[model samples]
Target: MQEEEPRGWRPAVAALPAAAAALVYAWARWCFGGAAPPSPAVAVAGGAVLVLGASAAYALSVRGAGGLFGALFLALGLLSTVAATERTAARAETATCVVREVHAETEASFGEGGAEKTVYRLALDCPGGRPGELKDAPSPLSRGAEVRIAYDPRGRLSAVPAGAARPWKPALSALLLLALAAVLAAHRRRPQP
Candidate 1:
């Protein structure tokens, strides 16, 4: 049975966009280079848990529903936060490393942009193979060419080009998420249309 509460809440729908984005990002990561490797069973299990948790929240809006939603929000929030931090660190850790490999990587366009842009995949040897540790990379990187790689000491392999960090990216993303959440919470207070 639906929980008795104010009618204007649509937090569930509000989360859909981010969830969808995450799903797409995950798919892209999994499908990188056409040599997609099987995700560990644990990842599937975790995804299942998230789904079940959301469903359970929808089903039982009693006392714990808010908590469940909060948990979900935290989960998504932390993921973005971590990614942002990792990227920042990676950029700061940029070091002069030889590009062991470079390959063309194609990514699908988002929104209505029905266009494809070419990107490159670079392999840099870091102190350790820590991922998600780069923010911006210097320009003109090529295979066998020495290029500056910014990476987090914690993550080395996930380093990208030096200028990849756009201050607006995370700022805009967080603002939108908060705005949507606020709108949904407000809607939840209104009678369901």
Candidate 2:
């Protein structure tokens, strides 16, 4: 058996922040539903509510660095959730499209190292009943090249390169945060030597 957190109180107390974060996150999601993404101001307000609520719950029960870390996790998880939701909502379909035209333009990069880069602009034709355009596409694309694209079948979102948006990212981040919180709680609850 593990040497730490043999007591039940530690686990119980540690679960509070995660539970609170989830509850607040659910409430925010319910408030928004499946509608379009909330405005930046609204999203910020919702995030503040989550951070404040979860952090307060953690701080009230446990007095230590855990509260700050818990708040960090909560903020990161909520941000991820909002971003994934917005990305998924923005696109509803994927298709293999062919590049109709390619325009390669060279632009100077202002990075720490002075460099020049080529930007491939492409016009793509898809079998999804509409043509699409992609800008600053990665290299190796030419006329009649087939590239995967994601778009809104209802024409709500313009087509973008595949993998540009991921819907499952938030879930993964939340799971990781919960795991970290559990570990932190167990460590903090260890008996003093």
Number of the top-ranking candidate, with TM-score as the measure: 2
The C-alpha local distance difference test score for the whole of candidate 1 amounts to: 0.47
> How many residue pairs clash in each candidate at the backbone level?
28, 0
lDDT of each: 0.47, 0.66
Over the stretch 26-103, how does candidate 1's per-residue lDDT look in tens digits? Answer: 533442212433454644465455544543443343224443454454345434533443334323555666666665
Candidate 1 Cα deviation (angstroms), residue 92:
6.6
Give the distance in Å from residue 171's predicted Cα in candidate 2 to where it truly belongs: 3.5
Candidate 2: count the clashes.
0
Shift in Å, residue 51, candidate 1: 9.6
lDDT of 2 at 11: 75
The C-alpha stretches of model 2 lying farther than 4 A from their native spots are 1-12, 20-40, 83-90, 94-148, 153-159, 162-170, 186-193
